[model samples]
Target: MSWTENIPTWQLVLLSIVGYVYLCRVLRYRRLQQKHALYPYKNREDFAKMTNQHAYEIQKYLFGVEFPFTMQKALEFALFRTYGIPSISSLLVKTKQLSEKQFASKRYADTVVLISEFMAWSPEAERTNAAIARMNYLHSLYQKKNLISNDDMLYTLSLFATEPCRWVNRYEWRQMTEMETCAMGTFWKSIGDAMNISYTPLTSSSLGWRDGLEFYEELHRWSLQYEEKAMLPSLDNKKTADETTALLLYDVPTSFVPTGRAIVSALMDDRLRKAMMYHPPPSYIQTGVETALTLRKLALRYLALPRPHFLRHDIISEKADENGRYHRIEYESEPWYMESNTRNRWGPQAWFKWMGGKPIPGTEGGLYRPQGYLIHEVGPKSQEKMGLREFEEGREVLMKAGRGSCPFSIGK
Candidate 1:
């Protein structure tokens, strides 16, 4: 028999009460500051009502992988750089009752809490603990074999303890950025143009790369005259850029690709390096700040980092594509294109830095470490080389591939 089915009604009630009380205590960041509070469920109905939403969402998450009611708990990979309690027993249980409207189920709710803790309260503690752990480890090694001077060992240990935070910050900052790429598409009168080019296309069109490029370029047209100076002080009287847009989908990717390529390349170029140092485009940094703030809004209570501060492009690296052809979105939780837009930067920005897409890493000797993204020199090859016409015809195609499941699997 199932555990819940076999349990007596009274026993279930008792367990729920105790579990909830423990959860309340856990919510309190510090015991000394305030006493723990109750779950605040006025009645069974209230508890069920709150929990039902999460259950529904969980079902959807599981259903996507064909594991709806019988879902596996998250593995203890400790893959992410956050301080979270291990063990997934609490995450596995599913209440059939809440499946209909589960929005804040225990699993998801707990995840939010953990996210908040990592971003907000846990960083300093984790840093300190890691340092202590390393020292202890090094000391144990020293005990095993006395090889070096105490001062040298001590200094090395100190560096090990403090080094991760910088790396963590770098990663966190980059993930907060969004990216996009545009293609042959059109918006309707409902969005903007009734006779737009985005509508006409069949898989059987456009044979080669040159033909495909020209074909989609027309579909994804941008009259550079207006957007190039929307805020030039002279254009203040002009309409908001979107008022003229038939659709919002194409705007983001088409614009981002070219400019992003140039901005990063100019920053990385040795010839332009001295001139642009510490004075990169205000738009780029502003976008980063905006991205961090947006994430802060959706962030769990634990992810409490201060507003991200931008380091004026002291160094920009141009080691990747100049056309800005990449398009990445981290909308696993988002419902639509707009929602995806909200979390756009977090993944692509990090990927961009990795694959020499933008902002060079460090300078050592005469060589720089290009960001870690795949290059198109070896774009994917398939039996049917896809063309612009096929993509327009609703046939899907991938232009590149790598060893892992997919290059896009950089982050969840």
Candidate 2:
């Protein structure tokens, strides 16, 4: 009170605002810590039994603690895989909607929501089912839009099933164990089955949970080779390249374009750089970045303290009750949830209304639907349906390409 009396009115007002902000943040952190403390499992073994904990942990570490690094990897993957697909890239280019809407932001928000739901210990069944249903609906929309070929779809799916596991294993503070690997394989397999892909690359008999570790390693190895030589139809086009580059460097200063490009080149492999026709960074710059990253990794491994309370809980879901019950209001209020609601034209309310509380058509009886949604209103599907033979052929190609490939082919 005495100190406040000595301060000017303007200073006092600014101090009050700062105090309020700090207090709010502290309260929020405490609330999150309290909420996560109620999580059913105290250790890895208990979490492993849930069959989705590995995916949850991966998402938690990526989004909550290491968002920037995760986003960097994710963007690199998208540039090489999703955007590289001719049909998908064409659709994006034709839309001319980058400035009006940022797809990366929306995709990140949606992923947070999906992963949070899939990982919820309370109402586990309901949340799991909802995540699956939402994924199936999205797959249907993609098919209806006729934006990607079946081969592209399978390739993309393979990347998802393998990439995160590989990234986390290599760069994350903690390496995933055998059980965690199995959980990841199981989780993706379930999603693949729900989406009704004609033939998933991984089979129980040969490449199932038992071979989860090897399967992920092999898939990751093959994907790296495939991505290196895989030609992107739009890569050479100036307009498309500029637009894609802008999307990648959104919010960055124009003056720093060279520096930004240098960083991007440093992050990507030679094959990816060549595929995108980007010039490699200077040797000094690359060496500097590598040195800094090595220091960062060492610091994180040996010096960094435990994550703070604010970074403990997922940023997508709200604090649950003591009984672990979550309410619709709580879900809608989450930062990621609210962001999605604001960005998407057809938000959760519209989705719920469209479904009318009925089970999604393709996910019935837990039977995989090879051909999604028989709706006649959507124009005929453009993508060819992938069959067992086609899936096998694609696997063979990957295997051949991965011959003599090392596990740590791409390093951070």
Lowest-sum lDDT 10-residue window in model 1: 178-187
TM-score of each: 0.16, 0.55
lDDT of each: 0.24, 0.46
Best by lDDT: 2
The backbone clash count of each candidate, in order, is 37, 0
- Tens digits of per-residue lDDT, candidate 1, 281-362, equal 4566556655754574334223332221242111111222454321211212211111112233345543443354332223
lDDT for each residue of candidate 2 in 143-220, tens digit (9 for 90 to 100): 777765555565666676666656665555555555455444445544444445543333432433323344455555
RMSD (Cα, Å) for all candidates, in order, is 29.2, 13.8
Report how far residue 52 has shifted in candidate 2, in Å: 4.2
| lDDT of model 2, residue 212 | 35
**Model 2's TM-score against the true structure:** 0.55
